[model samples]
Target: MRDGGETVTFDFAPMVDIVLLLLIFFFLTSSLGARQTALPLDLPRASSAVKESPALPIVSVDPAGKVYLNGEATPLTSLGARLRPLAQASGGVVGLRADENGQYGTVVEVMDVIRRAGGTRLALGTRLPAASGATP
Candidate 1:
């Protein structure tokens, strides 16, 4: 046999490693974003808003009328009692996060509760419009 031929091969290990790294990076980042918000909520859009401070007390209302105090599920009847201390500690300013599509009655009730809990000022949670690429 008198035949001379050369073959070239491409290694895919490096390419696969890069793809895996990218996948892991995206997965980690996406999960991290979810950590900022206690629960999933479709917040109302606002044209002007500022970054929320972590020091403020946070109250959230879900679409099903469930209430949350800084991520923990709280009963409507006892929310005021539980939130009172936080409100006072935060200087009577509380951050309220209510889902845009949630029950209007629940949101109103939550607001009333916040007021009764000694939260004199409310920092309503709203998302910046899609047109404006900003974080708040």
Candidate 2:
């Protein structure tokens, strides 16, 4: 070695492999969030409602009393028939997200229908009211 110069060495193969492994790890570990319904329902606000970490399957009941499962409108009479198969397939809880302005009787009716359809587990979706003087 005559004049000493800095040796240039670059190997990105290991870095690339590490990155790919990390990506795969994240993809495999991340929880799949709950599926949403197609129909939009303005849920009632609550001062104490807590947000669930993972979203739940939402069945929307509009002000007009129309029922929607996973966003597709289903007739009240056929609600149980339609929901049973979905519940069986998902092995997950079914839930209702109804407009606050909507009638309570309608929500009860929907619950009754769901129960009759063999949906044993159900949840209600709501968001907590913003704290006073806090930015939303």
Candidate 3:
């Protein structure tokens, strides 16, 4: 390349491709890690828990049977009304993050409230069971 009478060229196609890839990566991940409750709980293990799209509202039930709707504590009596709008907005789908140690009755009651609130699709959040003797 001669500096006196000629100019050098730069290829930006690779840079554009890399930028696009990163953009897509972040976009996909941002949606995948949708809003979740701050409470820490041990999720049950399942072999067939599938990820639902269009991220739905999260209903977290802690070990003591405390229920959180979108991270806000709400009485079970008012849960239906509180969740109705969210369920409708999310296309009648909802996510339930019940702690594995939570009482079964509480979970069932919560599910009933969810259904009464017009949630037609329920996704129970769970992780795959760890290998034997492996910390989850």
**Reference-based TM-score, model 1:** 0.68
TM-score of decoy 2: 0.64
Candidate 2: count the clashes: 5
lDDT at 79, model 3: 94
* Alpha-carbon RMSD to native, per candidate: 9.2, 5.2, 5.2
| Tens-place lDDT digits, model 1, residues 1-136 | 2255656678999999999999999999877652344599888888777778877889999889899998889999999999999899989999999899999999899999999999999999998666657644
Deviation (Å) of 108 in candidate 2: 2.4
Q: Taking the tens digit of each residue's C-alpha lDDT, what string does model 3 give over 1-136?
A: 6979888899999999999999999999988775754788788878665664546888889999999998889899999999999999998889898898888899999999999999998888887655574654
Clash count, candidate 1: 0
lDDT (tens digit, per residue) of candidate 2 on 1-136: 3367767788999999999999988877774545563455666666667665344445788888888887788898888888877666545567778887787898899998877766678777775676783534
What stretches of model 2 exceed 4 Å from their correct place?
1-11, 21-33, 37-40, 53-55, 88-92, 133-136
Q: Model 3, residue 50: displacement in angstroms?
A: 3.4
Runs of candidate 1 exceeding 4 Å displacement: 1-37, 131-136
- Model 3 TM-score? 0.66
Best by lDDT: 1
